[model samples]
Target: MTDSQGQTPDTRRDFERFYAASVKRLVTVVYAVTGDLGEAEDAVQEAYARAWPRWEQLVAEGDPTPWVRTVALRLAVSSWRRTRNRVRAHFRHGPPPDLPGLAPDHVALVAALRHLNPEQRRAVVLHHLLDLPVEEVARQTGSTSTAVRSRLMRARRVLSAHLTDSPDTPTAGAGRPATAAQPRQEVLPHE
Candidate 1:
């Protein structure tokens, strides 16, 4: 028997089984590469949705993992490009004058981030906030892993200096730790 979409029961079952087995791992891999969990999940979901239409062909080819992964990675990269463009446009046009005030810590963090050059900022966000490894950050940023490490080190120093110097930053006080200004280590290991 076939569904309304013309897929047979066996084909549907096979696709369902493949999705059930692969989704979690695939999302994890994509997240590691992209450094953004939301984008990773969206890309992986789109990849699986694409796979549904070609389930039989994928099965005949032996394993669909590689194909789905490639699609998801590409999608994630595309999304990143779009976001980058939007950011560029926003900078060119400038922020709206009516924007609400931010918390003091957040304001301090933004001020610190502003002190970084674009490349350093990207490296800090990807490797530190997003919790991507140096190698993966290098891959995404088109630099060597060593270069990524250097960027991270430099960024850390710069951030520390900036945060510590800012009077508005709570962490600037002698008694308080500057943890908010520091790059946090990832709790989970990358795949």
Candidate 2:
């Protein structure tokens, strides 16, 4: 099948090639955005699936990659918002009174995480929890590496303070959080 642009209107073969070429990179970027590998992969896959029907049109227009990227990102954000709303509704009273097996330190850490803004929390999760490099984190989060560095620096400072202050939270440092000011040093983009 041919489209008006003289491109193949049928997407199966082209879509297969496109999927094989783009899936990994898309999943990586989406993972950075969603901070969940499963969610990221799902979003990208869903985006590609949606694009399948319009593949010829998308390719005729321009790069299907960016279109897929945008759609996947929007899907991720929409899913996040929906999940957040559900959690809010579920915890209208509170966070289920905390789990019984949760250690005191864990509870305090969870509390501190809850105190952080969404972006800060994401910075923490992507860089720290998920162990993504700063550059990858920046790419996924749609921010510059410098911005991701700043977010991590600030988030670390806040987490350190929060942990240090909590009786249950223990610290390996000298019990003092580092000031925002620091000796000039290059931040590692990939660590």
Candidate 3:
């Protein structure tokens, strides 16, 4: 069956083509957004699954890849937010233990990212790390373009401030318990 766009209705063949053509790129985008390879992979898979039935609608509208990517990323973000909330709840109840294999640099980066509010981090990662256009990022993030720009600016400032602080040089509260070592593991996006 085909849609009004003259394209074949979504079928196994269409799904296979979409997956083959876009999986890698989508995985990379998911990884950049979520910072967790396993989660990103799962999210992408889920997104593709969800898109399969609506393939005709998606294909008729435009590039289904972006739609799938956005869905995957939104799912990942929702998962991340839920996990973060649980962790925060746990920490509030008790002292959190140190994360294993965490290095100072990684710790610093994570800390810096954490320092920024979630919106800022999302904007920064989408715009800078993933190199997405502001409009696209806004679409993916469900924010107005102007809001995305503002978030990107704020996130950049926060990241810059955190990165600029010399690791070797002591800043106020440098040795405080709040400081944690970075994770040593190199998080590579799944191929």
Candidate 4:
């Protein structure tokens, strides 16, 4: 049986299989890129939708992982650019509302991640979270390996500092002032 694009059922199945296998990972990667899970999921879904038409060609040429990732990242970047002004304005007036249904550690990690600039965050996510080599990250980010290394170093430092909770730092829900000094947490380790 052929679909509207004249592609066989096997072609549709291939795309479906690819989507099922990679969608979660793609969303996670895009979330690290966008610092917003909702936006990441939306961007990845859109990217997959776009990829549907070119599935056959993408499959014929090579693995479509890079293509889908690139498209999702690009879509996320576009969305970020469009919303940046609004975000800045919102922040100027007040802090972001607390997110519900997320673990404290997850919230802390994400908050620490926000301290990094886009380049640094992207480098950290690509190299550490995604387990890509520095060379591959450099290729993906269009930077030299040295640059990626530098960004990773800086990002790790920032994340380390941010994640480490000082005695003065208020605990998320603790009624008391803060507990005893906690050990310095290493959210991102040095290379």
Instruction: Highest lDDT: give the candidate number.
Output: 4
- What TM-score does prediction 4 earn? 0.79
Count backbone clashes in candidate 1: 0
- The residue-by-residue lDDT of candidate 1 on 18-122, one tens digit each, is 899989877766654444457779999999999888888888998897679768877876886789766456445533344346455554555566556656776
Q: Candidate 2 local accuracy as lDDT?
A: 0.68
Off by over 4 Å in 3: 1-10, 85-115, 164-191
Q: Cα miss at 144, model 4 (Å)?
A: 0.6
- Return the lDDT, model 2, position 6: 49
lDDT of 2 by residue, 1-191 (tens): 66554446445667888889989777766554454456678888899878977777898998887679768877976886778865455434433464556566655555556556657766776677557799977877789999888988887777776665434434335445333324567888986
* Candidate 2 error regions (>4 Å): 1-10, 85-191
Model 2 clash pairs?
none
Give the count of colliding residue pairs in each prediction. 0, 0, 8, 0
lDDT (Cα, tens digit) per residue for candidate 3, span 11-95: 6677798799889878766655555556779999999889977777888898887788778978888888879866456434432
lDDT of each: 0.71, 0.68, 0.70, 0.80
Q: List clashing residue pairs in candidate 1.
A: none
**Root-mean-square deviation of every model:** 11.0, 10.8, 11.0, 7.8
Which should have the higher lDDT, number 1 or number 3? 1
Name the TM-score of candidate 3: 0.62
